[model samples]
Target chain A: MTPHDLKQQAQQQLAQQASLDWLSLPQKAQATFAALDMPTRKTEAWKYTPLTALLNTPYFAHTAAGQVDESAAADRLGQLGDVSRLVFVNGHLHPGLSSYSDLENQGIVTLFSNANDAQRELINAELGTAFEPQQHVFATLNYSCIEDGVLIQAPTDFKVQQPIQLVYLSSGEAQPALAQSRVLVYGAAGSSLELIEQYDSLGETNVFHNQMTEISLQPNARLTHLRLQVEHESLSQVNGLHVKLAAGSHYEQHALAFGSALKRNDININFNGSNAYCRLNGVFLSKHKQHIDNHLNLEHGVPHCNSDTVYKGFITDSSRAVFNGRIHIHKHAQKTEAHLNNKNLLLSKQAELDTKPELEIYADDVKCSHGASIGKLDDKSLFYFQSRGIDRATAEAMLCLGFVNEMVEQFPNTAVIELARQRLAEFFNDVDQLNHLWTLE
Target chain B: MSKTPLLEVKDLVAEVDGKTILNGISLTVNPGEVHAIMGPNGSGKSTLANVLAGRDDYEVVSGSVRFKGQDLFELEPEERAREGVFLAFQYPVEIPGVSNMQFLKASVDAVRKHRGQEELDAPSFMKLAREHCKELKLKPEFLKRGVNEGFSGGEKKRNEILQMALLEPSLALLDETDSGLDIDALQVAAEGVNALRNPERSFIVVTHYQRLLNYIVPDYVHVLAGGKIVKSGGRELALELEEKGYSWIQ
Candidate 1:
């Protein structure tokens, strides 16, 4: 079908779904979705990734309700543990599988649908302010379909002792499906919250998950956001997170994206105040024909804002990965320090990684540097391990683990770091004997 | 029958690029002896170390190196490692993301597997590593940090010796590990090396300075120049060379 036909059909589906309060949104959101040019290879941002496979299938327009098996959902929720879980199956709230009463009572967590009018207005004011509407199509689509998601609000001077886990499960029955999620986090001054976002797919059907999360941090507010995406290999997903930081605010992000046929995570940060710190750390493992892309941008708009990012990619088989990070500093943003580095290891000759780390600085007083390297394992290190008698395969495997463990260990949360490590080990477990030639090492 | 030399190097003619570095060199290292290969800056001391470790850079034009009855050249670097041949690189590559414990475990397991031994579990490995680190005076926290990353000149040398202690290779080749070290670091590194010496394991201590020999005193001293051994003598040769300098050797 043509692009116009697809848009028309999607609009019709949304109109038929009366359970969703679609008319409440500003009229401009509908126009934004209508005008979105279906991403193709022709688009510069999606140049290396082609959307031909996604366009070929018809996705069931996401509705307010769908079939959600509690047993299957619980199985997926088990991975996140009992830490304040929020479950969404096939784009609908599976409240039976969610438990966050402690957070609700403490006034730290409030679902968007259940929030008061004042809280709703606060969330609406902060939602689309950080992310630009034109650049990201997925973010625009989420904005248009902003119906239900978790709204996290940490009161001023309150420090949360436990982590809040957000779990999303995409279970497609027959036709391909799509889900749009909106997450708004407002951390008041001197408040802290550790937020975890996890995605898991129950079935093998092709599903598309589009999500947008907006975070606004006041002065001295510390936020740690960990996003783990381990969905079915046939799913296509795109998650966009936009963070706005004030003075002395700290934001730490650790993201691990392992599955899905086509996956991309866009993180855009605006450093608006002084003494703000942000770190974006990620580890991505792709095998088979999976493709994962991470597009991150940090705008250092004010002085004395520091940001550091390290994203590692390990691709095997015919899989592909892309890491594009741009750190922009304005003219008046002096003493703005930012360092961005992207290192990728290709385990297959056919596996591809296109990494571009860009630093656009207009201030001569700022310290901005960016570097990207694409290579295989360290042969000298491999030889060092092997000369002692470790086989070539085991040596490479150990090196690969060490490579990813470097980033995983940076996670401040102990349980999350350990879980990520376990998953990483299991991810590499199959290649017990990784071919020496398979790794760049 | 002289217990069959643990390592035999016959007319080892190896070269880097088009220039011959180890020109017609030959040596034999027995299990119970410590051999010091000392030379000046341009002398092919490091070349011999690299060649013995089976590095791919050097081309063995026409020669043979044997370690424990195995064709050293026929094996890969890791294979050579498994057969108990270890080289203490003068400039150990700093692997930014690999930790000291992880690297040591992998190396030890490789060597053990090659000798038909089972791998050590976490507890045993940690216990073993901690013992070695204590003797080396290295902090236990170093095990958690990346290998040689942000390490001082002396720390890298100590780490190398620590690795040697863990691997416990039959033949350990040390290549100019004394360079860029102060007096105290030299003693610490030397003390670590001296502790690893045993009757069944031999060491080839390659250095440009005779100071390292003060602690890791070798039983045999050989002066290497122009990629070949020019002179051989007892342990006193190290002290004599330190007194007169390598200039008189010509």
Candidate 2:
């Protein structure tokens, strides 16, 4: 089938859902989705990530009314210690597998399906304020088909001591499924929060996950967002994250993605007020014919704002990756300081990486710089390690680990760091030469 | 000391990038002896060190190197290291995220495993590392940072000595380890080397100056000119060369 036919079929299936008729936002989102065209290779923003694989398959809209095994969900929460968790199966919230007693008492967690009158007003005011629906096709489709989502609010001057984790699991065993999940977070003036969004799959199934997350930080607010997507290799995922920072607010995001058949992540940050700070750090690993792309855009709309971005990638086998990082400074945004760096390591001869880093500064007084490098490991460094009694295979593993460890160390939680390290080791273990070297802890 | 030498290089000829550097150089180092090889600039001092370590960039045109009565050319670089051959690099490479403690533990464990010795546990390794750091006048926290990342010249040289102390190689090749050191750093490095001297271990200290010999006196001094050892004598040769310069020896 053509891409347009698939879009029409998806729209018809989404229109049949009972929840879409009750909400005006869903109605508006459906109109926006109809007005926009599906992104192809010719699209400027999505030139590197093709939609052929996602559109060629016959996929039906996923429903939250599916049975989920309690033990399976509990087993997936392996040692993420002391954090409040909210579990979602397919696209619906599973209350039996979720634990948010302390968070509910502090009025920090609110489910969109069960939002009260006051909570609904707050969710409506800020739910779709971060992005333009006409410009983001996947985000619009996510909003139009989203069954239920989570709303996390940190009150003014409140500080959350524990992290809040949102786990989304795909359990479509019968057929090819499509899931649209949404997350809205608000940090009030002078408040702080640490949020983690995790994605996983239950089985080896063909599932497409289209997710959107919108976050807004008020004046002097702080948020540390950590995202991990490590689904089955057969699955595909497209994620869009839009964040806006107010005056004196601080926003830091670190994302670790293990590429599946196809994966793309688009992250955009806008400085709406002066003197705000934002840091975007990420690492993505692709192996065994997988494709991963990351596009990061930072807009310095106000004066005296600063942004620092660094992304590292490792690709093996015939896998390919694309990284595009752009920093834009407005005309009136003087004294803006921005830096972007993208570094990649290609492990196999067939692996490929395409990276572009750009700095567009309209302000004459801004300090913006960008750099990108894509190559194999240094031969001299490898020789140095081999001369120290380490075998060549072990030396290569150590250097590869060291390359990715720079961003992994930036994770705020130690448990997440350990998880990322384990996954990285597993990825390297596929290569015969580097099978057992990752056991050095 | 035993009659059999620990290391014997017979007419070694090596080339880097198709250009000959070491031309028919022969040397023999017996146990418990410190042999200093001094040479002028472009005399192939560093090339000889690199060739001994089995660097792939330096092609062995025609030569033979034997360590403990075994052909060193038959083994890889790591194999030579496991068989008790150590080369302290002139310019150490910087590794960004691999900590010094981790690298040292791996090296020490590999060597120990080859010699049928038990590996040191974390606590024992930390204790030994702290002791070596104190002797070398380095802060214990240096062990936690990346290997040689952002380290000063003196610090890199001291780190190489610390590795030599931990591995305890039978044949230690010091490749200009005192080139960029201040007087205090040189003395600390010389003391570290002096403490490791024993009857069963030998050293080939490669230098360009006689200042370092004041602390760790060599039993034999050889002046290399045009890739060949032109002069060989006792420790007094180093003093005479220091006074007369390398030009007079040629």
Fnat of every candidate, listed in order:
0.65, 0.63
- Compose the digit string of candidate 2's lDDT tens values, residues A241-355: 9998999999998888887777888888989999999998898888888889898889899999999998999888988898989899999999999999998898889988889
Candidate 2 local lDDT, B1-250, one digit each (tens): 2489888999999888888888889999888889999999989888888888878998898989998999999989988888888899999999987888888888888888888999999899999999999999999999987889889999999999999999998988899988999999999999999999998899889999999999989999988988888899999999999999999988
DockQ-derived CAPRI band for the predicted complex in model 1:
medium
Clashing pairs in 2: none
Best by DockQ: 2
Q: After superposition, how far is residue B210 of candidate 1 from its true place, in Å?
A: 0.9
True contacts kept of 2: 0.63
Give per-residue lDDT, candidate 2, residue A413. 90
Q: How accurate is candidate 2 locally (lDDT)?
A: 0.85
Q: For residues A301-325, write the lDDT of model 1, one tens digit per residue.
A: 9999999998898888888888899
Give the range where candidate 1 chain A is weakest over 10 consecutive residues by summed lDDT: A432-441
Interface RMSD of each: 4.6, 1.2
